[model samples]
Target chain A: MTDAASLSAPEAARRSLVGWLLVLSLPLLMAVMELSVYAVEPRVLSLRNIVNVLDQASYAFVFASAQMMVILTRGFDLSLGTSVSTVSVASALAMTGLVAAGAPDALVVAAGLIAGLGVGALVGLFNGGFVAGLGINPFVVTLGSLNICLGLSTTISGGGPVFNVPDVFSRLFYNGKLMPGVSIPIMIAVLIGLGLYFLLNHTTFGRSLYIIGNNPRAARVAGLPSRRYLMFAYLACSLLAAFGGLMLTARTGSGEPNLGGSLMLESIAAAVIGGVSLQGGVGGVGAVVFGALFVTMLSNSMDLLEVGGYVQQILLGCVIIIAIFLDRLRQTRA
Target chain B: MTHIVDRRGAGAVSQRALRGYARVGFLPTVLIVLVVAMALFVPRFLSVQNVFNVLRSSSYLVILSAGQMLVLIVGGFDLSVGAVVPLASVVSAMTMVWAGGAVPGQTGLIIALGVLAGLGSGLLVGLLNGLCVAFLKVSAFIVTLGSMSIATGMALLLTNGIPVYGMPKAFVSGFGRGLWFQLPTAVYLAALVVAAVWFIQNFTKMGRYLYAIGGNLHAATVSGVRTKTYLVLAYAVCSILAAVTGLALTAEIGSGQAVINGQLTLESIAAAVIAGVSLKGGVGRVEMVTLAALFLLILTNAMDLLRIDPRIQTIFLGLIVVLAVAIEEMGKRRTPVD
Candidate 1:
């Protein structure tokens, strides 16, 4: 387990240095880019503005971390964004009905939260049942489920945004300040990030994901419950997305059935940009945070530069392609 | 419920028929049954106008699905086609707008150029997808997914979310509204595509090579199939076909819009799967996929006549796709046991 035990000190140091350089270079470049943009617009680099930007990216961070876990297991769950939308819509609809019936605001808010999480679990089951149990390819299966979730959400909400959410819900999760300097949403995002870090590093199940991803058949032969763990990964991914949906609902103060549409691409782009290997089992928690932050800042700087939203999308696509190319190049070098 | 045939003693020809029956034949049979049942209960389910509607709708869907089918057959999935259609539509619409009013003598020249512009732009998209997936050793899913984002953004950038208007009257009427022998003009185009696809898949060496590659990439490479060339070719055809369909659709709509048909990629894959095109690749037929597209359109048309809500209909559509895939997986399991 001691990697440097048999290696010369210089050699070990060189190896570690290489790893650190690869991890730090991209994020450092991104920070410099943001700083340059900040130089152009002095207000953008203000501490408050920086906090606001991080807060905006916090929701996406939640989505990307969960997506990273799924990708680590050699599976992709495209349904996550739709799962979030569905959960958000379902919860909003439930809240509306409860409020209309004069239900207590506390109980009603609780009900909506539970309903959102329930939709996530339901989507997870639908995806996992086919992907793991039936051995269908996860990509196509999740695509089907993404459509299914979208259909269900629109059906429930009549294809319109649900409005009139109680203010308390928004106040608690959306833009509310947890303390003098901390935003509630940012706090929650960090807490979830920490939880994921621990789960991925300390838990046996998390280790199983890497093992299965690296070699599924070997893991199977090793008596791992590959299917269950695989299913669990999807569940975790969707559940996190669903939670992000709740935050989005609170932030917007409405439930949109189609809000998750762009999330599929955004989360994938974030994870990939962060240096998570699409080949799976190769990303670290620190890299993921950097990735999410880098992607979000890239957007923030673009906005500061007054780039049109559509043009920003094109830039994002370029980033994803370049990131993947870099990943491929590194693999060849190794 | 009744097992009428004693399948155990069936002869080789019949058993081959029966195995085929279990695989491809069953889906078409189910489609026929559903159509008949709908016809029995839903009025206008078989009307000429309604049937024409289904045919017209399916013409483009079948075309798009064929493109998807090509990539799927080669073991690479092209999600970029979903974006390509919108790109083609928007660009073509803009081209016609630039060409301005069609002079009687110059109309043909302009339309031809428009077609070239569309195909050429599509060629670029395909080239990017093909090169990345083939040479760069990138995953097909991510490459196409990345391209999809790029294309979608380009479509938006081209139009600023505004629909391009003032298409030449001749261009719209000829490509979109004109008909021959009581069939929409687009059907003829679709038929040409399907026939070309059939010819390519059967008569051409490249098409056969697709199967070999999909069947086993490493083995095919070792056997010297030039996988890089075919892989790029498959994606190129897939993206270009998607553009053709997009151009046709934009002409029909009388303008170019930025939004993509969200269901195009999913529906195409579903049709391919239901028609027995394995996602694992190296298996399928154009004829079966064509029928599968027709069946899906018919099913949707019947549902519309039956007053099913559109949103609920989407749920059913997704469920059926997943169900078809599950059934295919189960059938695969049964073969190992047999």
Candidate 2:
């Protein structure tokens, strides 16, 4: 809706300033939270606590990034949480089965990763094909897939956690560090975030995706391969989610059929709070990172303050509503 | 009658009937086939007890789907209905307990107060959702999603993550698990809701305005329709009916839990859509949606009878929804102009 070509230089400057302010608001919120927590207990603001919060935010960052890609192209993936669960179960099963057969550690890990990513890719392909090729509603398609994935995960795991994964797999992927005080999850999340930032800001595919989301008809008229781009968006989203699931498996040292509970909603919340437009064609990786961090920190601070989980849920709902209200104001002004 | 018969012959009359069936859509045909197949294959599938059991179990879903149909007709979604069910149950159960203790031996007063409290909770949620979607101009999905979370939180808070016990014995047995005229009491309640919704959808000015609004908001606004009021009314009615379902379920289950009927939100939407309710708005029927809900119930019931795994049953449900929507899409493409 904000046409770049039609805006005057001064108006554009003002709009960009507002956008920057919105992005900065996440960190600003984080600071406010820090102050409040410090007021309650200064010891909670230690450097160690900050690192722990970041560690907690690692999964949020990954899931939010994955969600941001699909949202950028004007699609929703309600199946992300279930898909992650499926992937976790699949990969864990593969590693455990291979290990039981006396396979080497490297082979077991490779097989697990491949099985997990492969399942993710298949789910993505199904979603993309229905939404892009058949033109079905994204919500319905993803909703259906969400159920299917949940069923598959539960069925394969027989309604329990899959265990006995190779220890080396977790060590190399989740626990190992290039240096002390830096976790593998944090590194993976950062690498994915930076990779997406570059891809979104510096590539023709990314620009075309923006144009397509902004106005699909115009993109088609201008000869953009909108279908392929949309398909790739869903595929990439599921793949990223799958990678995150693999990391979760490594962290927990097992395949949890219920892994990433409520993650679909949380990731969407993070992306939306970080300034990603649900209507699409607006947002950045930087905004989403801060958004994920802000959400993680809010929960962490609440835990420190001994807030009930129910209250946290209520506050989260309120925060999402407020964030969207602000987003509407920004849009109208722009 | 003779003249009509002479003019249209037998073939023409059958053709007209076939056309009417087409207009009603393929759901009925599918339902019939599924029913016949199950009756033939599954033992005891046609017994009176099993038939009544299916109807009893599907009553809640039927009511919820009728409510969902109202919202779909207005081009909106209410994901919060699932959360509202539990919230209503918890609030009502808690109220009943407190009131019963306050007024010892006043069973009637306690039940009435509980029902009122339950409906009030639903109304509050509905009002918030409707106001946000109508006045604030927020997307219905996001507003309902937020309310869903809020409502779930409220339910959990009220019950402290535990089920509320101590419901009046008479209330639970006479209403929740009662039989009336050889059918479950819930069936009568479900029928009353269906009839009420059907009447509103067909014979009310507000319903017509809602249809006009959903069909084309700009045109309806130009034609002097109060689009906002009708939209809110639709959402409110939807939530109230969901609340009714919650009350019935609470009585049946004999407790108020935080997570009762979590799947109803998705299931209700699926039933409406599968019954040929247009998500794009301005189209749906109460009878068809009720029938669709029954069909879904029967499908699950049959699967259970066949000793199928519950997980596989979930997969079947998901596949059926997608397949139905895909078929509808193909049908639309074939008829391009419409």
Candidate 3:
């Protein structure tokens, strides 16, 4: 990598080919899928349809971008989905009460973010505590918390959606225009993606993630704050997951305990299909943005083609498998 | 690491205490406290009927966890077991309806066929999982996750999200209604299974190989272990055991639910960990898993007596898993590995 500046022309071209193959394959495939769908329904390629795809991808974009970084550290957060559910329910309760009591709109929205992200952070704290400090497997720790969050969310909502939220909550948070035509959720997603890209590329904590991810012993030897960084990674994951959940709630104008049932898998699929190495230390946020977009686009295309939901699920599973299989091939060769 | 084990008890009584902590964890202590607390505080907690109820409902969990422990011991995770339970149960229930179908004379053969069909589905899953993981060298986590979704999709499609009803009267009566020694037949069957798994794990060469592989895969391979074959065999056995449990539970319910036991995979993983099974694999005992199953049932039973909602019980289960593993891990950290 340090010798890249001295590379010959043919070698540079080969490197470019490899880079495109790794980063652009999934998005190109998604484009092809969309083009095929466009053949059947030309409306699918319209400007309105493009925005809808972006909107649909936003919530998951938040989740996947966070998840990709955690995976880069060779850890997972199965509880992210359930944590999202829990926080959404908690935020809904806070928001609804505030609105009913005639609170100002600013206070209501502020309360929602605080309550939502608070619950997320607390869950992340315990998860990271046991996983990092006690040396327990992250999978087991997070898996247990996942169900805990699920139970709490359902119990709080009495196994239903919590409604009667202030119209302003959804109106401004989800559907409000950031620009003349851009949705708030899309803006948030883009900003978060860019924020993560800068963080991973420029920050000390972010560099620690790549180092600790690549080799834990080496990171320890280098005196990087590996454990602290791991804790922060999980914290960031849950925090972002809650933000996504809040967006989803605002989009529907209600808090749903059952929201994002498939989110853990979906987040993982997006990150993995985006060419993120599950072994840790090899991925970027830009690629993950494309990955999340590809997933949403694929789903939209399938819907346009009128595929059965069950078969689509089977296809989704196949894609995860194939994505990892390609990753293994790259791993062996690299 | 080997040196510490060799000098384990030689003037190392203090070190032995940490090892003891790793072995026992907080499970036995927590179980005793829970039992005492429930017995004193929770109403009707120790009633004979309630005891039976707890035992009956958790039979499936115990059986599933035992199978899962085997896979974990061999360095794999079988997330598909959650899907396998419903798929196995539904397929067999439908088979019973088609084959036995209130047929008096041919009930026995059809019932046998139905059980085989259920086991067959699990076996096929085991084979596919084993091939992709052991042969193709895909990580067990990703492979099982893929299988989890695929099997779940297939199950939902097969049953159309509805349960398979009308199990044979004779089968239900035999499995559920009739009690041997004042307990459901499922209890006795679960006991028989525990014994069988104990035998296989403690007495078989495959069991030894599984531990070897999990402890260090590269070293095991270098030492002439057939890691791939045993990996597949272990997964096959694990899936088959899960199938057996599913069959019994389906019969007990008198029908097969398409979404029955959605939490089985997580619950199984949790139970094994609470029972002192290392999530990294290579350590655990069948008896410990059995006890953990009972501990889980008692905890839930106590909570039920307090009129706790089902969802709250879910929280308690998760907390127990994390707390129990945390206790064990803290002990491990106190002891230096090398």
Number of the predicted model whose DockQ against the real structure is largest: 3
Task: Estimate, for each residue in A2-116, the C-alpha lDDT of model 3 and write its tens digit.
Answer: 1222458775566555664654457667777888899998878989989899988887789898788688788888897888889889999999989989999999999988988
* Tens digit per residue, CA lDDT, model 1, A310-329: 88887877777777777665
* Candidate 1 wrongly placed segments (more than 4 Å): A1-25, B1-14, B101-105, B336-338
- Can you write out model 2's per-residue Cα lDDT over B1-338, one digit (the tens) per residue? 24435766788698557556667877888999999999898768998999988999899999999988898888888989999999999999999999989998999999999999999999998988888878887767778888899999999998898999988998899999989888999999999999988888789998788788878888998999988888888899999998999999999999987898567899999899888888878888999999999999999999988999999998889889888888877866664242
In model 2, residue pairs whose N, Cα or C atoms come closer than 3 Å (at least 3 residues apart or on different chains), thus clashing, are none
Query: Where is model 1 chain B poorest over a 10-residue stretch in terms of lDDT?
Result: B1-10
Instruction: Give the clashing residue pairs of candidate 3, or none.
Output: none
Candidate order by decreasing TM-score: 2, 1, 3
List per-model TM-scores for chain B: 0.92, 0.94, 0.91
Q: Candidate 3 lDDT, tens digit per residue, B63-88?
A: 98998998898778888888888878
Report the lDDT tens digits of candidate 2 across residue range A1-334: 7733356988767666667566355677678778979998786688888888888788999999899888888788989999999999999999999999999988999999999999999999999999888988787788889889989999999999998878898997788867688888888888998899888888988887788778889999999988998899899999999999999999999999999678898888888887787787887788688789888988888888888999988887777777677666666666
**Lowest lDDT block of 10, candidate 2 chain A:** A20-29
What docking class should model 3 receive? Answer: medium
DockQ of each: 0.64, 0.63, 0.66
**Which residues of candidate 2, in runs, are more than 4 Å off?**
A3-8, A14-25, B1-21, B336-338
Clash list (residue pairs), candidate 1? none
lDDT of 1 by residue, B73-122 (tens): 98888878888898888888777666656543577666776767777778
